[model samples]
Target: MRYLTRGLFWIAVYLGLALFPCLALLSGNMPPGYGYWWDFSLALGYGSASMMAIMFFLTARFKRPALPFGVDVIYYFHKYIALLLFLIVAAHPAILLATEPVVREMLKPAQINRYMAAGVVSFLLLTLIVVSSLWRKQLNIPYDTWRLIHALLAIAAFILALIHIEGAGYYINTPGKRLIWPLIMVCWLLIQLYVRLIRPLRLLSTPYRVKEVIKESDEVYTLVVEPRQHEIPAYKPGQFAWLTMFYSPFSMKEHPFSFSSNPEQKGELRFTIKELGDFTKRIKEAGPGQTVYIDGPYGAFTIDRHPAERGSVFIAGGIGIAPLRSMLRALADRKDQRPHILFFADKSLEKMTFYEELKALPDQLNLQVVFLPQHPPANWPGETGYLNREILTRHLPAHLSELDYFICGPAPLMDMAEKELHAMGVPLQNLHSELFDFV
Candidate 1:
């Protein structure tokens, strides 16, 4: 019922955005239409512009608004929806140019007006934003730098698009319609201030200090930080937080990591990070007393949300076991008697993280661990090779389809596991996965 309410809320929000321009147009006198295509172009332009404005709201990380749907899903929506809306915005101009000779004439450099020029520049900036994001890894753009660029480009494009719309003066001719654009602009500005200034200020006031950094494996390390002044809120197992180390909260250089620590342990937070990205690679060098800022407890992957789940199946690869470990520890602390199954995979036994801790879990809770190594030791007796249908079917309980499957790992592994789970007749709602790679 909670999930349904959230879904419905988001649907209503989208419907409101889509119909905003139409509502404004109807509220007051509308200017003369340039036939069907031109009028259609204007409607599309307004709708797409509205979408662009709301993109900021979606990514702003407002806790209450994001509580319904995980922030991770919001980001994925922001990414794909940006692309779709960009196409719609692009079509706004394309239809005008293709159908109207006046628009084609206005496109010429010598004859272009300021309004036309603004629209052109806005389109170009939007194109750059999309291309850079889609090819950031290939283009070798640093995550921090790319994020800064993305924000700036989005702001500039939205501003220029608004200018183009106001100057074009077609649908927004009346006093009420004119007031609407500025009101929307103010709302966007407020959201930007909250995201960029206010939230960072709050984070700065409540800082955390690194108590220790423990090496979990050759490539994975556990960072332990405790609140310096204020007590942090308790996060659910399987949720993640953004860590800003050796930088100010306003620096925008944070990286997301799962809370590997038992949330039952208050005042202290733990993140098990692997040497993967540029930021994570430096985690090994981090020492005690380093001040860090955290901005989360976000994500909908927690088992606590599904209180009725009798059993859970956790599938993890490499460092993806971080969140699952938190859940297991929480269950153990509660002395949970529910059946729990874990399939933890790594390249070899030596590479598996928290080996001793995981081995001791069965004694604490009704748990079973299945360790799969890509390259097993000569005398190894457990399952070997990648996760496949045969391995899952053989080990999964007879009530496999009824169990909640929590999968986390590299993208490819998660994809394969989800496919296999579906193939084995698990319902979609029962299969949960977190895509933590948010830019």
Candidate 2:
């Protein structure tokens, strides 16, 4: 409840920031209207710029403000909002071009001015951002390259929009209004500083040394690390961190991975990563004594967040089992007596990460392991084929509404489980998931 309150407070603050610029423009001496459409276009322009500035704060990893909704959730919201906000931005010019003959003339090479050019370029950059992000995989753009491009384009668009607005000199004509506008822009600049400059600098102070790397399965490897100069940051079992290694913190080459080891142990940390991306493909090359900088302990997909009154259930597909391993290990260390059930979907027993430990976990805690291998060997006793509604009904216990359920893995699997479980009488609040695809 406290987290929810704080979350609501931050949202209110965001609303104020987004709406303040429009209010400032209107609060000043009013200018004679050219028409309703012309004034409406200007209003859209101001609102879109204000929203663009706020984008930095959304992705800044404001850990406390993001407690009620996880950073993962915010990242997804950022994606959604970016798309919506871009439409507003596009409408600003579009409405003007359609309704105002003067706007069309200004775009001509003969009449184009610096201010008009800025607005044009800003809109183009915003278009690029949306296209690159929404279809990154289809475009075959490298992840790090795309991030650098995205940040640079975003900053340029915001600054250009501000320049275009200030140059036009429409509504914010009074001295006080002019002063307030610059201050708001400056505040937005500070947020950008913290996100791109200051935060990375802070991460440099704390570092970890890679202890060893162990291949957990055919497609997964666990990288073990211990704190080098400072104590390990306290973290919940199903949390993740952004790791920068083999490259400077300024490189923007960081990737997020869940804590696969037991959080109860403080001496060392472990991250079990799959060979899926450019970063993870190189995990096998990470040797001992390499420096690593971690920037998190974020996400809200842990059993520790709520009291599991009627036990818990975990549904995992492929690499999604990393965070669940952390929770299971923590429960074993604490000697938790509540009933626990795990439905792990994988290709085969040999391909599953932590196969040995999972088989051994039932003895330490009140846990049951149910493997759903897609390709089972002859005479295999466990369930085979993909995880779907029928298999879920067969394994899941009665009174589903009372138990807490954590589902992670591929996007499709999570989507299916979330929908199916909710339809099967599970309350929305009882289901939790970690969405790494957004990250």
Candidate 3:
């Protein structure tokens, strides 16, 4: 209920920001309406620009704004909101082109004004951002290069949009009306200041050094780090952080990973990473005493968030077990005797990342470990293939609907498990999943 209030508050704040400029258009001494469709299109242009401006704030990683909704949830919002605003922005001009014949004349290469060209270029840049982001892998654009390009293009598109607006001198013709945009410009510049310069400078002052790298299994490794300047801040068991190892924090090449170690142990952080790609594969080369920058501990997929009077259920696949391991280890360290169950899915017995440690954990806490190895030996007695409704029901506590479910893994597994659990009467709020593939 408290989270709901915070969530609603943030939503209200977001709506207020998105609608502020549009609302200002209704203020004192307004311009005469050109036409219904024409004025409506202009309103959309103002609203879309304001929404785009706020996107910078949304992705700034501000802890307070992100706490109500987890960082992952906020990012998902950012992606969808970008999609919605793109359509609105495109519609803003489409309506004008259709309703005002003068707009069609402005598009000719021989007679386009500078302001019209600015608007056209801004729209093109925005389209490129959307297309490249959605099909980045298909187009084979490098992720780090995309990040840098995404930032620069978004900034340029927004500035050009502001130019397009001010140069027209339509609604914001008067001095009082013109004041609003300068205010927005100040806010935009401040956001850029914090994201590009101030935050990176702060991260530079407090660096974390790699303590060691432990090989977890065939392809997974745990890179441990301890702060050089001061102890790291406390974070929930299943929280995650963005680590910059090879480059400075300003490089924009950092990768996000879950906290594999329990926060019960102070002054150290562990990230269990898989050799999945170029950025992660570099973890194998991380040596002791290497300097690294951390920018998080943001997420909401922990056992600590929900009450587990009758215990809880955890579902993981492959390296998704990272956050679950943190929760289990933290619970064991605290000696929580409540009944807890884990359904871990992997390729085979040898391929499970935390096979031995999970097997050993039941002795320390009242925990049930269910391993679903895809390829089994001769007469495997345990579950296999994938997590389904039957597997969940067979092992889940009798009070199925009362327990909290924490699931993280491949998209297919998480999607299936969430659907199956909800169908089997688990409350929607009782099921928690974090979508961290931020590509």
Candidate 4:
């Protein structure tokens, strides 16, 4: 069923691209002073090229796996095609001007037109988005701020391009062609509106009020929120949710924080967040009675989906301990006596997100927590340094190959863990990982 859905998605994507050119070619009317046959061919190629660019951006945002292939490969293909489409679309005006003298006249200041203006605006916006994204770190623009700007600019570019196409009356001459682009724009707009606005408003009614804030460390703070309404949905151990504070969806600045408390306990939902970025850094100042909106429970990084007979190993680092803690607490509440080992890595013991809560879990659950510190304290007895192959082999169960490993951490740490596991002969299927960042 999953394969079938993916296949249909790709088919629809290809069909959408094909339809753009087909519509332009079969318009049955050419722009003034251009040969009908020539105009039809040019319009067909231009439309297909534009649609290809659109598809590349859309697919990159919402990744879908292809049959017998990895999602990573599809993403690379999308990147390459996007670059190709940019070149094709960029040369379109030059080609038209060279072939049709009428287009050259339209480019003149006296004949300055809406289509030409929109085309220019679209190109500029695309250039800004692509360039800023590619060099975001080098340019020193933060991810959150860049994301907001990127979304706004993308919407503006799409609107301008759509108006250009409709107002030009060349390819979109017929009533059908005119209706198609507007309908597509309206549908796209509505989806964004629902995802960004409508759904968040619904969450406002069933609020989760902040009950308490526990300061685990200088930077790490754990927030306990109790539902004011009747019932809050019980999520799986490792699942995450989008949390919004102070009723501002336009703040649209929601972050995905893992649940640190047990899911079984409906008394209060706890989230242990580290002061990392602009949004999270402010979490320390949040007090009791503050209203928060949670739009989740998303992500598939839990033990509920995959039951193992042998045991489970959770490898986490820094703030990555949020989900792992939730899993531990949930298991303890259920009294499921399964052997679980937690390999938590951090710069220092003081920076650990949830130290006390983790220590208390062993009494109620069958678990062992191993903290790996880069710089251990004067008389620290726990493991030190990074989580390399030696550290994993020492702490891991004897039947490591039979165990299911769940790893969550920084990109570099996660990569190292996966490599070490693979070197130790763990099957790829048995190893699961979740990346926090979308990029």
Candidate 5:
């Protein structure tokens, strides 16, 4: 059933692309030497390219790691498709200008050329977005600021592109094509409006009141938000939620934080945040009684969905310990007897996010916590270095193939763990990781 649904979705997308160009060619009012067939082909190319862009953005936003092959392949697919779309869209204008003489003629300054001007503006904006994204670091723009600019530019591009298509008077000549594209645009706009406006407004009626804010470490703070009315849906052990500190949904400043508390507790949602950027730095100062909006329960990294016999191995680094702590607390709360090991790596013991809480979990569940500190304390007893092949092999299950590993941390740490695990004979299928960034 899932495969059928996915197949049908792709079919609809392809048909939508094909219909644009065919409708352009069928329009009877085009001038001579226009090569209606060429115009139709260019329209199909542009439409398909734009569709790929939309899909990439959606997949990236939703953090879909795997597509269908039971592998983390969709991330690479999204990246490549974005590159292809940029190249194809860049060529779209050139193809139209060269193959269709009437399009070039339409570019002249006249009252009838307004549609062409709109198209040029839209294409320019799209080009700017593509270029800026490709060279964002070189441009010296931060990710948060670039994200805001990208979103606003995309909205502008979509509006201008729609106006250009409508004013072109080709596809609009057909009632069916006119209705189809406009309806698709309206649906897209409505979805965004709901995500940005309606959903947040709905959350206002059921806010999570801050109960307590505890400083777990130098940079780490744990926030406990109590449900004011009905409790929020129970999340899986390793899942995350999008949180807005301010009540306004339109604030354009929401952060995805992993739950550091156990899922068994329904009265409160706990999040451990590290002071990293503008939004996160203020988390430590937030007091009780402040209203926060929670909009998630997303992510597929959970132990509940996997087989119990597979066991569990958690790899965490620094503040990446947030989700791992959630999983550990959950296991302890449930009194699950499954064998699990937590390999936590940090620069120092002072930077560890959940020191006392983790130490207390082993009293309730079958678990082991191995701390790897770069700099050891005066009487440090635990492992005192980074988690590499030797440390992983030493602490991991004797039968590495029987365990499922969950790794989350900085990109470099995750990469290192994955490499070490694979070298230690853990199958790729037995490993799961999540990328927390929108990139």
Candidate 6:
């Protein structure tokens, strides 16, 4: 129900943006409908520009509004909607170039005006934004640097688009039409300031000091930090937070990591980070007493919210087990008797970070741990190789569809696991997945 309400709110917001140009036209000084194609092209341009502006608000990581839909889903929406807006906005000029000879004439160097030049520059920037984002990893751009560039390009493009519209003075000729755009501009600026300035300032004041760094595996480490002045925000098991360490929150370098500690344990916060990126590679260097800023407790992939579930099946690959460990530990702390099945995948027994710790969980709670290693010793007697339909069918309880399944892993493994579970009769909604690769 909460999800439904949030969905409706976003839908209404989008509908309002789509209709804003039409509303402006109705306020007088309204040019007669220039023909269906011309009006539609202009409307598409206006709507797309509005969507581009709102993208900032969506990715700002506002906690309350993002509660219903997980931040991962929000990031996915941000990526796809950006593509859609680009297509729509491009159609505006394509139609104009094809239909109006005057537009084609203005395209030539001698006939071009400053307004048309601005529109052309804006279009090029928007194109760059879409192309760079879609191929960010392929382009070999660092995530932090890419984010800063993306934001700057988007803001500049939107501002130039508004200027082009004002100079064109076609649809936005009336007093009300002029007022509408300035109001929207004000809102956009406020959201930008809040995300880039106000929120970071708040996090700066509520600083956390690193208490310890525990090596979980050769490639994985747990960075534990405690609050210096304010108490850490209470969070549920299987959720994640953005951590900014050895840098200012405003530096735009914060990275998200899942909480690996039991949430019931207060004051100190633990993040399980793998040496996957530039920032994460230096995690081991972050010693005790280093100040860190956190902006999170986000994500809905948690077992606490669904207490009614009779049991749970957890599927994890590599460091993806971080969040699931938090859930298992919390259940053990509570002495809950609910049954759980953990299917943890790793490359080898020696490299498994929490192998012994997980083995101890069965004594604390009704839990069963299944280890799947890609390469096993000849003498090994347990399951080996990748998790497949056969392995899942043999181990999963007969009432597989009745229990909730949580999967967190690399993209390829997650894709395979989800398909296999569905084939084995698990309902779609009963299976939840945590995708950390937002880009």
lDDT on C-alpha atoms for all candidate structures: 0.89, 0.88, 0.91, 0.74, 0.73, 0.87
TM-scores, all candidates, are 0.98, 0.97, 0.98, 0.79, 0.84, 0.97
Ranking of all candidate structures by their lDDT, best first: 3, 1, 2, 6, 4, 5
Clash count per candidate: 0, 0, 0, 0, 0, 0
How would you encode candidate 6's per-residue C-alpha lDDT over 200-310 as one tens digit per residue? 999999999999999988999999999999978889999999999989999988999999989988778888888987899999999889999998899989987666367
C-alpha root-mean-square deviation, candidate 1: 1.1
Question: How well is each residue in 1-439 modelled by candidate 2, as lDDT tens digits?
Answer: 8777888998898789888878887874777878899889888888888888889888989887788888888888899999989999999999999998988998999899998898899999999999999999899998899999999999898889888887874787788877765886888888878877888888888889999999887778999999888989899999999999888888889999999989998899999999987889998999999999999899988999966788899999998999999999999999899998999998888888888899999999999898988899899987998888898898878877899998889898899999999999999999999866773
**What is candidate 1's local distance difference test score?**
0.89
**Model 4: what TM-score?**
0.79
Best by lDDT: 3
Stretches of candidate 3 off by over 4 Å are none
Give the winner by TM-score: 3 or 4: 3
TM-score, candidate number 2:
0.97
RMSD of 2: 1.4
lDDT score, candidate 6: 0.87
Candidate 1: tens digits of C-alpha lDDT, residues 343-398: 98889888999978898889989999999999999999999988888989888988
